[model samples]
Target: MSWIYLDNNATSKIDPAVLESMLPYLQESYGNASSVQHRMGREANQAIEVARQQVANKLSCRTNEIFFVSGATEGINMVLRGVAEAYRRKGQHIITCRTEHKAVLSTCAILEKRGVEITYLPVDEHGQIDLQLLEDSIRADTILVSIMAANNESGVIHPVDEIAALCRRKDVLYFCDATQYVGKQDLNLETTPIDILTFSAHKFHGPKGVGILYIRRKSKPIQIPALISGGKQEQGLRGGTLQVANIVGCGKALDIAKQQPHIRNYRDLLEREVLARIPQTFVHGSKAKRLDNTSFIAFRHIKSAELMTSLPDVALSTGSACASGLLDPSHVLKAMQVSDEDAFSSVRFSLSKFTEQSEISSAIDELVHTVEQIRTLSPVWKLFKDGLID
Candidate 1:
């Protein structure tokens, strides 16, 4: 039987159109963008610039503000480290939340080791941070506030607009990780008041290894030290040869994603049907704003790893792909104050533009059967049936 692929948040499949746009750069136009002396190099350079403009136009920012990087992780490291170095005299403190992706949290951990005061704000039961606490956490010595646009595991969207406004009022630089939010929806940076932003293309049907970092130079006039120093690539801030094919694919992916409708209806049907079919299933971020393509469901008395392993035909994840192989509860769920049992029982079903209704139906049927079959072998499930556990 053909397998159903729902692990889209982990990474999307390459769109055929994006691949077609990138072919020339990979084959015939394979030239060093840094070497503008030759025809091939000039062609490659022009393509890269066009991509920059496309990215900027989509985000409603100037083309010069767009900088290319390997991926979101490198961009996060660059922005966090560069800003800390550039504004050390201003302050050594940075603010972020506990529900952020591992990339942001891990980078903050390193900054803490370097004597930077990192304030990890707490989240509510729904994985949303308290804006009042964030405002209170900002001190005169705080240099920056780094937050993500959405949660990768739960599809919970942070109040980025309020966060940006808060940072602006506090006179602190704000860096937003838009990796999960971008391409999934429209974000006009022109009026958002964000100082810096980062996103990856692979999340939106583009090739991997290419991403963009937007720095506000016109309005707020933000600047940071260079983390990688060598050539003039990325305005001498990031030094390395750009991935020509991947860059082309990145722009095309963003262009395509902007035109596609949200897959929320499919996600809703899946969530509604699963809850009706299962014994005790809960949806995370159900009431809050979320990506239309994501559904995080917790099945009580069921271990997600065992469930996923049993359903080989369904490509789903129990947590972030980075740590889903482990048996530990997801850190995102833990931050939301979910019990250990619920956390381990949750599964993330992320869809994409390419996903079809049939796939959702099939996956849901398989999930219902698997959850029921697995619970039959569990003492915990029996106790729950007997009203022994809540």
Candidate 2:
């Protein structure tokens, strides 16, 4: 049986064009980007610079602002821990939301043990942070405000422009984890005043193990200490031999994603059909603006793990891939005040520009049938059918 993959937010399949662009570097051009003495090394270095330009063009920032890392995890670590150490004298307080990815939250947990004051702002029922609450959270010693551009699970977009403006007014540094929204949304740093932003290549159609961190230096010189110590690389912020082939693939992937048609219509069609055909199912974060390619739904009284097991051919997710192994419910859903039962029942279906209409239709049919079968075995569902539950 053919599988229908709808988990693009976890990681997307590399585009053919992107793979083609990376082939030369992987096969023959294996010179280390740090080696500056030899011609082959210079060529590798030039290729890396070119890739940096590509990412910079997409983000509408200077090439010097872009720093390549292993992926968003490293980029987040570099920003949070690096800034915590570098700016500790400036401030010890940081502000963020409860719905942040583990990369940000986990790092914040670590900082807290080291005497950093962290305020985890709560979200509304719609999975959106209150701008007023965010503004009020800033203090005299608040050094940074880190939030994701769009939620990985719910796909709900935060009001990043307003958040950036608030941070600017408070004279606080703003960091946006744009892993989900970078390729799907158009962001121009020339217009937006976000101080720091991060995105992973695999979240788009690029090869895995490559990410970009954009640090805007035009407004003010914001400096963070290097996370890794080694020979000079990534302007001394990150020290390692650049993954030349992956960086080349990332550049090509971003170029392709920017030119692809929007997938919002297809995603909407899938959501509509699923809600119409299935009972006791609701879409999470439905009240807020979300990524065009994502649809997060919850089936009442049904566990997503069991539902997914029933539909072997459909590739979906319970939540962020990084945290999926845990048996606990999604923290994102809990942040939105979803009941524990509803949270466990939730599943996220994220699309890509490459998803076809036929694939959507097939997945919908299979999901509806599988959900129905699961509900039949559910005691809670049976109770509801007998008018014992409201």
Candidate 3:
């Protein structure tokens, strides 16, 4: 069985063209971007600038706004930690959604230990944050409002444009983790008014270890000190020798992603078939605004672990790949107010542009069979069937 990978939210398959574009950088143009005094180094530096322009072009932001980072995790840390420290006198409060990626949540947790008050805005049943609640939550001491453009697990898209406008109106800085939205959605940072944004390359079929952090330059003056400061790299906001090849790959992948068709039809087919075929199934955040590539499905009385294990040829996820090992039902689902029983039974299937219609059908078949098999063997399912439990 040729393995079908539907976990694109975690990490997508690196595109062949992206790999080809970066090969020369890896094999031949192995010059330090910082060492631009020499010809090879200048060429490497030139490649980095070209990649920067590509990312800037996609975001509709200035080239100076984009800075390379290890990945979104590092970028997120830098923004949160830096803002918290640099703007401590301005305010000690931060507002963020309850369903943000662990990167943001965990950093907020650390900040809490250091006395930063964090307001975790709750989501309704459909995993959408109330704009009014967000607006009201902003305090005079609130220094930054952080929110994800698209959720990693449920694919629920928060109203980022509205959020950005609200922040601007309230005179607060806003940071958006656009990790899942960059390649899939149209993001115009120039007009968005978001003070900062970050996204990873691997989410868009780019190489791992390369990411971009975009900080708005002209109108909004926000100061975020460097967390990894050593050299004069990233305008002294971040310090590290650049990964030239990976950066090139990230740019190429992003350019490629823009041209690739949205496989929403395939995602819809998978969800539609699963709901029609499976008797007791639920799609979390189905009614909410969502990404076209992700479906978070719950099979009643069935553990996600068993279902995933039974289908070895298919690659799916119970939750974020970043939170893979722990038996905890997704924190995102928990925040969405999903019951313990339903949460444990849920699995996330994320598609990409490359996901074909044929693979969608096959995935649905496997999922239907697996859910049936698991339900048949489950004592809990038997009890539910016997009317012993609801």
Candidate 4:
């Protein structure tokens, strides 16, 4: 049976146009971008530069500011670790939100072991951080404030512009992990006070294993020491040969995403239908600004894993793919003060531009059926129905 994929936040399918754009580099134009002494290498290097410009154009930043990395995970590690090491003399404090992706949180954990002080800001029930608390958290020793543009599980958008402005006033460098927000939203680095931004192409209909790190160049540029050292690529910031085909795919995918209409209409329709059809269901981050493609919902007394198993044709997730295998409640939900049982009952349905109205209808039917079936076996659900539990 065909699958109805609703996990775009985890990763999106590569667009056909992006695949076509990458074919030449993978086939005949497979030359090392660094080897400029030869014609083939020159062609490859030119392609890489063109792709870089494409990405830069989409982000509305200078081409020199973009650097290619393996993926967002590497980019996050590079920024957090590099800044911590390079500016060790300046300060050793880094502030980040508690609901951040494992990429940021895990890196911060490592930094903590190495004598770096990390302040994890809390989020409200709607999965938003307190702006005043954020500003108050800044200190003379705080060198960086890293926050995500959007939550991977809840899809709630953070007030990044306000956060950036606060960081600027405090003289703290700001880093935004835009992996889930980049292609879906407009973020012009030229106008924003963001010092460092990272995104992976796979999150936006591009191939996997390719990402971009935007380091703004200013009079007092944020210095980041090299995380990987080899052939002096990426201005000696990140090393290793460029993945030409993947980079080309990323550029084409980002260009397409920028041109496409926002998928909010589809997402809203899906959520409306699901909430109307499924009893005892509610949305996470409903009051906050969220991405147009994400819906994180919790069904009382229904385990998301069991629901997912019952609807094999519907490609949904309990939470972030990185932490899904751990069998623990979602860190994001826990941070928002969602109970452990409710967190386990929650599932994330992230749509893409390619999702159709028919698919949404079908997913809702399957989900409603699956949840009803699961609830039939749940004594907790029966007790709630009898008003035994509030």
Model 4 ranges off by over 4 Å: 259-262
Off by over 4 Å in 2: 218-220, 259-262
CA-lDDT, candidates in order: 0.89, 0.90, 0.91, 0.91
For candidate 2, the 10 contiguous residues with the lowest summed lDDT are: 253-262
TM-score of each: 0.97, 0.98, 0.98, 0.98
What ranges in model 1 sit over 4 Å off? 218-221, 259-262
How good is model 3 by TM-score?
0.98
**Residues 80-173 of candidate 3: C-alpha lDDT, one tens digit per residue:** 9999999999899999988999999999999999999999999998999999999999999999999999999999999999999999999889
TM-score of 1: 0.97
Residue-level lDDT tens digits of model 2 in 1-390? 478999999999988899999998988888998887998888889988998888888888999999998889998999999888888888999999999999999999999999999999999889999998999889999999999999999999998998998888889999999999988889989888899999999998999999999899854689788888897898888887889999998888887676345588888898899889998889999989999988999988888899998988889999899997898889999999999999999999999878889999999889888888888888989898999986
How many residue pairs clash per model? 0, 0, 0, 0
Per-residue lDDT over 1-390 for candidate 4, one digit per residue giving the tens place of the 0 to 100 score: 368999989999999999999999999999999999999999989988998999999888999999999899999999999999988998999999999999899999999999999999999999999999998899999999999999999999999999999998998999999999999888888778899999999999999999999999989877988888988898888879899999889888888786245478888888898889988889999999998888999987888888888988989998899997887899999999999999998999999888987888788888878788888888988999999997
Relative to the true structure, candidate 2 reaches a TM of: 0.98
lDDT at position 16, candidate 1: 99
lDDT of 3 at 259: 32
- Answer with 1 or 4, whichever has the higher lDDT: 4
Q: RMSD in angstroms, all models?
A: 1.3, 1.2, 1.1, 1.1
